[model samples]
Target: MDYQIARHNMVENQVRANKVTDPLVIAAMEEVPRELFLPESKKGVAYVDEDISIGNGRYAIEPMVIARMMQIAEIETTDVALVIGAGFGYSSALLSRVAETVVAIESDATMVEKAEKILQDNNYDNVIVVEGDVVAGYPKQSPYNVIMFDGAVAEVPEAILAQLAEGGRLLAVVREAHKVGVARLYEREHGVIGHRDLFDANVPYLPGFEPVESFVF
Candidate 1:
């Protein structure tokens, strides 16, 4: 496959026309080989504008959703970023360039292994892929400048919010009822005080992020 052409098409058709105009994000997408991150069986479909299934109950977010969330996060060159539900390390690779350091958290052991190999092969030194549950978040690298849920969540748990630094920001596609929208949440000294929905998207559901179930007597 002509990777360059596919990347260009992704920038033009999926990102630009869809309103993700940040130059840094576009450049990152161009730099990272999305196909390399996906499973060998699905490499050809990497940039096809649809979410690809990564093993262990996780799915990579679509190009449009990734681009849009990255653009909305307004990541700075010096910012520290955290990516939850990092399936094949696609989002982690894309974020490495925009943020100073990227901490990618994946729950599935096999997927983490695959992602780690891919990131190392690409020489992305700024990223660290670790296995962990999404609900707990990665506290070892707390106080992230930008926290991104790379998949859709039923609700943002307070545990994750506690990891964000003061004035840090988080972006995620929140699925409320049946509707879904990308939300940008800001953390302040007191707490995660404010957040606003940016746009609607069809993102994959994140495992273990739903509200706790109670016994119905």
Candidate 2:
């Protein structure tokens, strides 16, 4: 299969058609062989418009959604990023192309192993895979200039927000209901984090990042 041509179509059709105009993001998505990150059975649909499940309840978010989120991030060339729920590390791999360094956090051991292997084989030395709690963020590399959550979350945790460097940007899909979610960008200035909705998207929930339910009787 000619993945380069297919990648061009993905960027031009699915991504740009959906309003993702950032050149860096487009280039990264174009360069990365997304099919390499998927299981053999799922590689055929890597660039399709839907999320491809990489197993363990994790899904590689749709290309347009991921591209749009990266566009909204306004990634800086010197920024260091953290990707929560890195999944198959596709997002992290894309991020490594934009950020100076990327620390990808994954809670699933199997997923982490797969992500690490692929990232290494592809020579993504700028990306480091870390196994730990996704909700907590990876503080060892705290105060990151960019932080991105790979899946939908009920709410962005304070712990994660606390890791954002001053003037840093953090993006996530905030799911308000079963089928409703909004992609939001949170930027910290003078130690205060301000947020605004970027777009509407619904992706698989990153386990442990969900909001705690209240009991009312």
Candidate 3:
């Protein structure tokens, strides 16, 4: 299907056109074979500017959304990263290119298996897919230089924020109630974690991250 051409077009038209200016981010998006990360039935449409479901209530978020998040995080070559809700491990693969090491957490067993296989087969050796509770954030490897939520969440848990290194940055699409989501970049400076809205996003919520229901009068 001429994936190379399709990939080039996706970078130039969907990602680059949307203000994802970081050269490393652009290069990673251009180099990764996103099609390999999707179900066979969805591969033909891999480069489309929309999320593609990968079963088990997970979606491979739109390329532009992830690209922008990476750029905002400003990942460094020697940083350690943790990706919550790794899904098919596409985002982790992208992080592996820019970060020294990556630990991806996924709750679903099937997903963890598939993600690990795909990553290993493709020689993305810097990333490891761990099967565990997604919202727990792999604290075993605390003090991550970068933490990314692969999907939208109602809130960012303090436990997750605690994993960020003093100068680390975390990125997530925060959606509350039914309102539109906001992509936020959280930074830890002087032991304080603060966040600023980067852009508006409306992507699927990672399982286990849904807001708790409240009682009504």
Best by lDDT: 3
24 Cα displacement, candidate 1 (Å): 0.6
Can you give the TM-score per candidate against the true fold? 0.92, 0.96, 0.98
Q: What lDDT tens digits, residue by residue, belong to model 3 across residues 1-217? A: 9999999999999999999999999999999999999999999999999988999889999999999999988999999999999898899999999999999999999999999999999999999899998888999988899999989999999999999999999999999977899999999999999889989999999888887778899
Better of 1 and 3 by lDDT: 3
**Which candidate would rank higher by TM-score, 1 or 2?**
2
| Model 2 bad stretches (over 4 Å) | 211-216
Q: Which stretches of model 1 miss by more than 4 angstroms? A: 181-184, 187-192, 210-217
| Per-residue lDDT over 106-204 for candidate 2, one digit per residue giving the tens place of the 0 to 100 score | 989999999999999999999999999897899998999999988889999899999999999999999964558999999999989999998888887
Against the true structure, candidate 1 has what lDDT?
0.83
lDDT of 3 at 59: 93
What ranking emerges by lDDT with the best candidate at the front? 3, 2, 1
Instruction: Tell me the tens digit of each residue's lDDT in model 1 across 33-82.
Output: 88888778988887898888876667878888888888878899999999
Query: How many clashes in each candidate?
Result: 0, 0, 0
Q: What stretches of model 3 exceed 4 Å from their correct place?
A: none
**What lDDT does candidate 1 reach at residue 67?**
84
